[model samples]
Target: MKYFFFFLFCLLIGIISLTAQSLHFGYDISGNQELRILQYDDDSQSIPLPLNPEPVIIIPVPDGPIMYTATNGLEIYPNPVETELIIKWDTQIANLLVKIELSAYNAKLIEEVKFRASDQKAVLSMSQRPSGVYYVKIYCSDGRIINHSIIKK
Candidate 1:
């Protein structure tokens, strides 16, 4: 009877541990099957696994309104710029009021300017700013807001 009770206690513990474990399966470089069962204790740190070449595909189906550009002639140049940033748009959108904002990575506002859009071009100086990543947000009068990421060196 004592032996039967000891066996039962061990079986219960095994079942509990199995229920608390996480299992992952993948193929190794040699085309062999790899199974990983991990259990984390308070002192153990978890490390991320390397990305698999064949990953699961997730297709996004948007449920809300989708915003798209009405015109395709918008252009910006000299990415990773040092001194100046140029913006040019379609001639059809000329003379519209545009609110241009330059912001840091943390959404902190740095400079804001309002300009009348011209098909020719508009130049913005970046010589005074330090080297970092910045975002330029252009808000058009037709409710279109475009965002461009720029790096200043």
Candidate 2:
């Protein structure tokens, strides 16, 4: 009787595990397996506070909205500029005329570059600039504008 109960318990456990696996993973008619992944919506997009001393910059994926901007297809890098600053955008906005302006903390315009974003990238030379707070303003032909702060070391 003891051995029969043990065997029954083992079988029950096995069936429970198989049921849980089928609930979590799907099998197709052709015997192909597919996993259902959990997805979060745009409103839940946020950066978590860093646990380390180093700062973290969360770059939104192509599907998610860009930070601090309504537009979705732009990328900037190296916030604490050392030599050069690079700005890039999606090809969808490549034909739009883009005006990139760099300014000082006091709202003084420093340098401006106007061109078609078809090139997909803009490189600004900051090697000659003084180390201080600065701003980068990008204006798109679609009437979208984004301003970002850059710290020069």
Name the top lDDT candidate: 2
Evaluate residue 139 in candidate 1 and report its C-alpha lDDT on the 0 to 100 scale.
Answer: 69
lDDT of 1 by residue, 84-150 (tens): 8887777765655367788999989988855556535678898998999998887666666777888
Which ranges in model 1 have alpha carbons more than 4 Å from their true place? 1-71, 95-97
lDDT of each: 0.71, 0.72
1-153: candidate 2 lDDT, tens digit per residue: 999999999999998766543223445799655444332333443333322435579965333212434266777778898999888888876766458888999989999965556688889899999999998887666666677888999
TM-scores of all predicted structures: 0.50, 0.51
Clashing pairs in 2: none
- Model 2 global lDDT (CA atoms, 0 to 1): 0.72
Judging by TM-score against the true structure, name the best candidate: 2
